[model samples]
Target: MSFRTGKDFEFDPINGTNIIAREIGFKQTTFYNSTLTGTHKIDALGGFTVNWYGSFGILDQYIPLLQRLQYNQYTNLPGSPYLALISNGLSQKSGSVFYSTLSDYLYNAGGDISKSFTLFGQNKR
Candidate 1:
């Protein structure tokens, strides 16, 4: 979703009346996550009993631009600088916020083997 409105003065008063300056929202946002795991087991050379497992995973996200501006709650103003006018057009569709970006990756590997012999009540290894 996208909604853009013109007129951005957005508060620039330390004590000199406004000259016009604004900076809003995000310029860059980034994240990355990765994982890996493994397990293996082996027993008996002639009887043969073995188990194994493996896994891998990854995720990534990045945001380049998100622009929004609004200002109304700052007290203290004197007069010194003046030059403020904004015009580009107007927009209306107020409900706000809907932007997303995502990327993901995964990998897998596996192995297992087993062998056993039994009769009544006798087990020794």
Candidate 2:
């Protein structure tokens, strides 16, 4: 009639030059089901069934990089104050789901990136 769940994150600062980090977590639940009975057997299935599940994880080292770019002090360029810059990035993600009763499955994936834009009107002339 009741359930519990938990999660946690781990970090290792000694390995991989501390340039990366990893995380993991899990959850579980338990309950009784009265309708889960055999075919054409209502009185035969008089007990309750319990279901539960859980998960866990760990994290690697993480190291952040710092960089600085210098430009002509007098030139107020379009991307001044380092607010705008040419950046090319890509991302992708996929997932799926299934239904036992309907025997249905679904999946999806997509990613894209465009040129960076800056609100030039806000720049001080």
Candidate 3:
């Protein structure tokens, strides 16, 4: 325990924390017939994803021997030690919290067409 003065020392000890999480997504496509004169081709893709996170924690110290310095009612009460700075119970309860989320999607489409023509000599196609 650490000392804060002639009449005060480290007493209240507590811990707090939080957490989070998420999800993923994917997509793909294919096609046939690659040429206008011979055949045609096409492809596409689409998908969506989701994710979220949340966390919380708290610490509380409740001891009858411990005292709060803010209250004068215990100052001149005889055996009641003079506490300089402290909490009475719920007033000293400490905690933390966090929350987050993510959701989105992507889509794409593509196609192709082609043809061959004869030029001058030797079967150029």
TM-score for all models, in order of appearance: 0.27, 0.20, 0.20
Which candidate number maximizes TM-score? Answer: 1
Best by lDDT: 1
Clashes of each: 0, 8, 2
Query: Which of candidates 1 and 2 is the stronger one according to lDDT?
Result: 1
lDDT of 3 by residue, 1-125 (tens): 21222211123123211111111222222222222222323232222222222333232322223322231223224556533333334542112122223222223333343333357754332
Error of 3 at 117 (Å): 1.4
Model 1: ten consecutive residues of lowest lDDT: 89-98
lDDT of each: 0.43, 0.24, 0.28
Off by over 4 Å in 1: 3-44, 68-115, 119-125
Off by over 4 Å in 2: 1-45, 76-125
Write model 1 residue lDDT over 1-54, tens digit each, in one string.
233333333344343222233333343334444444444344556566555565
Q: Tell me the deviation in Å of residue 13 in model 3.
A: 31
